[model samples]
Target: MNGAFSLLIPVYRGDDPAHFAKAFSSSVGEQTVKPAQVVLVQDGPVGDVLAAAIDHAVESSPVPVTRHRIEDNVGLARALDVGLTLCEHEIVARMDADDISLPERFARQLPVVEGGVDLVGTGMFEFLDDGGAIVARRVPRTGHDEISRYARFHDPFSHPTVMYRRSAVQRAGGYQPLGLMEDYWLFARMIDAGASVENIPDPLVMYRVGAGAYARRGGQAQWRSELELQRALRRIRFTSRWEYVRNVSVRGVYRFVPEGVRKIAYRRLIAKG
Candidate 1:
């Protein structure tokens, strides 16, 4: 891809501008490859302070920066669709408004672009409720065949950790509007399109599983979201059982095991192949 990597952060409901700016600086400032641009696509109305923070971030980025604010509140998948149209680079990586990308996130993935992989994801450090403490690290590794196998059963790439080729994403027809698991839908498509994917073996993103960020909003809406997710996965030809049980168990842990540790165990299985 030309000009290093392009980072896209989709904002909705006025995400913390200061945090976003810190994330931008953290991502680009410590990287050697240097990003081509950081595109801030606001999916919804952000507060004035956050808006100013975004502008400041755009202006201050050592690399190029672009900002696009939508008139209405578009969901994450559609927001990503809009941003993809504006990306000039062949490689596009994703960032969430509230999370932080590690210093080496970009530099580690940029050189691997030409290796014929359709997408590459990396390990993650999920933070605690306080954000000061890290709960666990999730690093996934598997050969091409095993990653594809895992994708059939579950999404192998953590959404924020992915660096995707524009053409590969386009060929998969881009993100689906699945509300709850849009990234998972897209990964299933990518695997069908002959896309090879694997996660770099180290924590490349610091994710604050912050309050009110979906998981915490666990009420009627969350339940319905999972119901919708089942239908969405079925559309891609995965068996219904795959969607509800195995996939669910494999994602973020279930019953008792911590999510990050579960991923490490799965990677061990993949590596044995």
Candidate 2:
């Protein structure tokens, strides 16, 4: 609350530009602790509507909004890497283009970060498209030791709901190109490096989850990415041999399972809102 933070967001051509812009602008506007600046990174060529939406959000925002454009579609990890460098504040909060951050989100996260936590995230309420209905809630592990232990098998924090110290991220080598698991990859390394991490027990963001969300988490490509992440964790000694094997086995079951089963698993087993 006392110090300003930068909201870092990445926008790609695939997103619904108008929806994204509106959600982002409204969320930022509603925050109790307004950001000093909002850094919006355009990852690739966007259509006229999306481009115009970006411009409108920037022009209408109460706080200054800085826009960065990449020549081509560079994907989330690289786009975030670039966005991180553009952040004007040491404390940077990550927001997805489509997710809605609750009004009190920054108010709650700021104190945690300022209290010496290198990275702080919160639980999230997963909603349907347009946030018309709530589907699930994801409560991540809290505390440094608990988070480090949880990281051995799963992501201990929600990426979109995180506020991390810029220096801590840079010290951990920034974001890497790890496909859909990029956030998890970076968090794993940060934990390995002994960065202090914590999570607020309350839900601070409305995470939009469409019908196809779980399907996107499946597939051969995603499986390969998860495997790669597991290998990385093994190399970092974040996971022992048995833990790595168990992780891969459990993840594989979820990945190769039927769609209906996966949905049930995600809503019931995985997300504990």
lDDT of 1 by residue, 23-67 (tens): 777777766666788787888787888888877877777888778
Model 2 lDDT, residue 77, Cα: 93
TM-score of the candidate numbered 2?
0.96
List candidate 1 stretches off by more than 4 Å: 1-3, 129-131, 212-219, 240-273
- Measured by TM-score, the strongest candidate is 2
Tens digits of lDDT, candidate 2, 2-28: 598999989988888756975686568
Residue 271 shift from truth in candidate 1, angstroms? 16
In candidate 2, the residue pairs with backbone N, CA or C atoms under 3 Å apart (3 or more residues apart, or in different chains) clash, namely 137-273
How does residue 54 of candidate 1 score in lDDT?
78
Task: Tell me each candidate's TM-score.
Answer: 0.84, 0.96
What C-alpha lDDT does candidate 2 achieve relative to the native structure? 0.88
